[model samples]
Target: SQTIHQWPATLVQPVGSPLSLECTVEGTSNPNLYWYRQAAGRGLQLLFYSVGIGQISSEVPQNLSASRPQDRQFILSSKKLLLSDSGFYLCAWTAENYGYTFGSGTRLTVV
Candidate 1:
C-alpha cells in the first residue's frame, strides 16, 4: 500500500528562478526514490535517486539537486532554474518485485 505524494500540481516560472518540489512516500521503508524529467517530444530521464536516508545518487549534473532528510521524505531543489528546466517533474519509487510507480507529477512551465 505504498503511495507517493507531490505538490503544486503545476507551476509557472520565469527563466533564472529558483525551484523546489517535494515528494514523500507512505507505507514503505528504505524505498528507492527517483526524480525524473520528461520534456516535450523527449523521453524520461533520471535526474536523481535516493536509496536511503541521506544517500542520493545523481544521474546528471545540471541546475538540480536532491536530498533525503528522512526515510520517506525526498526533496528536489534548484538554486537558479533555467528555461531548459521546463518540463514534467515526476517522482517515482520501485519495490523489490512490484515495479515502479510515479506521482501525479508537476508540470513546470518556464518562460
Candidate 2:
C-alpha cells in the first residue's frame, strides 16, 4: 500500500516568484526518491534524487533545489523561478525489486 503524494496539481506563477512543491511517500522506508521535469513534448530530465535522509544529489544545474528532511518526505524549492523553469514536475520513488512509482505531478506555468 505504498503511495506518493504531490501537490499542487497545477500552478501559474510570475517570473522571479518563489516556488515550493512537496512530495511524501507512505508505507515505504529508505526508498530511492527522485524529482524530474518534463518540458512540453520533451523527455523527462532528472533534477534531484535522494537515497537517504539529508542526502540529496542534483542531476542538473538549475534554479531549483531539493531536500529530504525526513525518510519519506521530499521537497523541491526555488527562490526565484525563471520562465524556463515552467514544466511538468514529477516525484517518484523506487526500491529493490520495485519499479518507479510516480506521483500525479505538478504542471507549472511561469508567466
Candidate 3:
C-alpha cells in the first residue's frame, strides 16, 4: 500500500518569491521520484528526477531544483519564481513493478 503525499494543493505567489514543494512516499523504498509541470492544456514536462538519496537529475534548464534528502523524500525548490513557472506541479514515483503514481498536484499562479 504505497502512497505519495504532496502539499499545498493550490498556491498564488508574487513574482520572484521563493518556492518549496515536498513529496514523500510511504510503504516504498528507493523509488524513482520525479517532478513534472503541466500547463493549461499542454502535456506534462519533466523538471527533475532522483534515483537515490542525494542523487538528482535535471531534465531541462530552468529556475528550479530538486533534491532527495531521504530514501523516500523528494523536495523541489526555487530561490525566486518566475511568472512562466506557474503551472500544475505533480510529484510522482515508481517502483520495480508498480506503475507511476502521481499526487493530486498543486496549481500555482504567479502574479
Candidate 4:
C-alpha cells in the first residue's frame, strides 16, 4: 500500500528562524509531488509541485522553497521564517489514474 508521510505535525517558531519540513512517499515510483497551504478560512493554495527529481514548480512567491532529493522524497525549507508564513502545510503525491494521497500536514506558527 502506498502512503505519504509528513512531519513535524506542528511547530511554533520565532520570527526570522529557519524552517524545514519533509515528506516522503512509499510503495510508489516516480510520483508527482506537491506542497499546498491552507489558511484558517481560505481555500487550499498550491505552493509547489515536482514532476521528477530536481524538477520543482512553485505557484506562489511567498517565503518558501521546495526540493526533491530522490524519487520519493520531497522537502520544504525556508532560510528565515516570517509571521505571515504561518499556516497548514501539506504534502501530497499522485500518479496517472490515481487520486492524490496526502500526508499528515504541518501546522506552522511564527511569532
Clashing pairs in 2: none
TM-score of 2: 0.97
Model 1, span 1-111: residue lDDT tens:
888999879999888888999999999998999999999888999999998999999998899999999999899988888888999999999877968889999999989
lDDT of 4 by residue, 7-101 (tens): 99999999999999999999989999999999988889999999999999999898999999999999999999999999999999985677888
- How far residue 34's Cα lies from its native spot in candidate 1, in Å, is 0.2
Q: What's each prediction's TM-score?
A: 0.95, 0.97, 0.96, 0.96
> Model 2, residue 94: what's the lDDT?
96
Error of 1 at 48 (Å): 0.4
Candidate order by decreasing lDDT: 2, 4, 3, 1
- What is the alpha-carbon lDDT of model 4 when measured against the actual structure? 0.94
Clashes of each: 0, 0, 0, 0
Candidate 1, position 54, lDDT: 95
Expressed as tens digits, the lDDT of each residue in 1-111 for candidate 3 is: 889999889999999999999999999888999999999999999999899999999999999999899999999999999999999999999866768899889899989
Top candidate, metric lDDT = 2
TM-score sort, best first: 2, 3, 4, 1
What shift in Å separates residue 4 of candidate 1 from its native position after superposition?
Answer: 0.7
Candidate 3 C-alpha error for residue 68, in Å: 0.9
Residue 105, candidate 4: how far off, in angstroms? 0.5
